[model samples]
Target: MDFRDHLRKIIHVDMDAFYASVEQLDDPSLKGKALAVGGSSKRGVVAAASYEARKYGVKSAMSGRQAARLCPHLIFVRPRFERYKEISQQIRKIFFEYTDLVEPLSLDEAYLDVTVNKFNFPSATILAREIREKIKAKTGLNASAGISINKFIAKVASDINKPNGQKTIPPEDVIDFLEQLDIRKFYGVGKVTQDKMYRLGIFTGADLKLKTLDYLQEHFGKSGLHYYNVVRGIHLSEVKTTRIRKSLGAERTFSENISSEIYMLEKLEDIAEEVERRLKNSRVAGKTITLKLKYSDFSVQTRSKTLKLFIASKALIMEETKALLYQEPIKDSIRLLGISLSNLNTEQPKSVKKPSIPKEEQLKLPF
Candidate 1:
């Protein structure tokens, strides 16, 4: 089918409070409580928060300490990735039964092109309903869906009626929907971008739609063009069947900031060993090594070097990291350190450092 025709039947499926919900599902005793899934230590960040905790302003990415301050009664639980992946696979199996044009944004969310589904269903909304029902029955968990003419709108709509609900934005309503959307809820607008938009007096999609494409590009770089197009219901990207691994990385924030270089080396060794183990599991190696350091004040510094050839050994990774560490003097105390491998042998891999508009064929899409 033509890509344009396929655009009209996309559905974005997202699990509700995935990690916390899974934890609650496995232990029903924990079900109605305000839960934060991750370590309870001062340095730990909440990976996910239950709906109850969200009402208390405890959310994912907030420090456990802050989460505790927000809700003194918040319960903490460690994450189980293997178990989540197991259930995710089962949920995906249900998706494959309907369509193969499934693009997973993460384990808990995906975009599916149901333009031509297995059951030959005429209405994508009905298909999305059935898919969510199947997920609920099979996993005893709730899944939300948004059906729209394009992926971006579907993704945004998915969040409107969440936790076992669905929303559909038909083709005729796409333009008005985008225009009425808050600039903050435009899907791609981050806090930084939102601040920039506020400065530009662009508070809503209607406000964004007023700016010229060239003006946006001058301000937002290439992302400006994206803002212009999406507000006009012109996203031409398609759901991919496969997603490539861009980079493998792990980071840890210390309970207390450290200033001594000697202590930093000890932490680097442990992080490099972890990178090696992950590289081996993925069965891929890379030449580019990036060492990330987050200072006590939350400012971040990154150093990277690409080798003549890819190497995966912990010894080699550590050897390179040690040289990079001393390459420049670190002026401030650090609270977090991380290591990652990129430029993999996985045939033209792209790093996930920034969000760029898809490079698919772009044309003036009629709203």
Candidate 2:
């Protein structure tokens, strides 16, 4: 299939180590130094790591103690989330100049559909280069981009050339590209899935393509169909401009674990207030209240109850959560407590329809 004939021009742009880069940009002294953000305390977890720290095998989500062991001189700094959001908004304004079909994945990454851009430019490649240049001039930061016929391939390719590079996989080469891709490197293949694929001799896209639909479904369930299609260069997901929030939640990890339910009530009240604030901001309500607890040993437990009517007030939310919390006996000291509301009144998502390609179509060979 010639994606040029039927596919959208998608570009995935990602900021390089966003939080660490911003910190370095603000403090010149931190530039070229091993840096980690928000991971100094004994119980703290690293939110982001700079390239220099990464060279020492430091990574986001690593424990502060472990990161310190990896890179002894790594500098730890608090995260200034407001500043990051300020810069993210500025970057998005630049995206709007080219196309309104921008889907932000996070503060540092987004998917842009430039098939019909403001400039009417036929080459999405040129647009990507220009966008990155504009972002560099505006933020003094480097970004990487992946240009392709779909969001999944674009997201994967963006990571191929990191920091300040970009990779473009044209429609004609997509099949070959996916075929040669490492199973671990596929966009959604996590370690557990990768290991499973390895056991099944599905080490590459080509390997995966050999598996029959029935065999895959029996082994991997619903994900089997997705793997079968993606390897054939047939992804139907669109770049959504607005994502639906299925659930809203607030949680806190306490410095000390509480062994008594009575001691947890006050903490639950504070969390309920936060959840109410978030609900008020979103102007939405839900019928389900779920209470999540993480034990001192890192195990987790959740209890949920669905109400007859959607409720958003803190009083009602707390009342429902308290009932669920007290319904079950506390088995262990709780280190974390969370409350989430689902079955929201917000608009539900509609499935995207597949393209009108005939069954006789074949992927264009790069040779």
Considering every candidate listed, which one attains the maximal lDDT? 2
**Which residue segments of model 1 deviate by more than 4 Å?**
1-6, 255-257, 348-367
Query: Which lDDT tens digits does candidate 1 get at residues 244-326?
Result: 78898778888889999999989988998899999999999998999999997778899999999998999999899898889
lDDT by residue for model 2 (1-367), tens = 4344457788999999999999999999999999999867455578999999999999998877789998989899999999999999999999999988888998999999887679877788888999999999999999999998889899998998898999999887888999999999876689999999999999999999899989988998999888877888778788787888889989887777888888798999999999999999999999999999989777889999998999999999989988998897899999889999999999856644433433244233111
Error of 2 at 132 (Å): 1.0
- Score candidate 2 by TM-score against the native: 0.90
TM-score of each: 0.90, 0.90
- In candidate 1 the C-alpha lDDT for residue 253 amounts to 81
The candidate 2 region of ten consecutive residues with least summed lDDT is 358-367
Q: How many steric clashes between backbone atoms does each model show? A: 0, 2
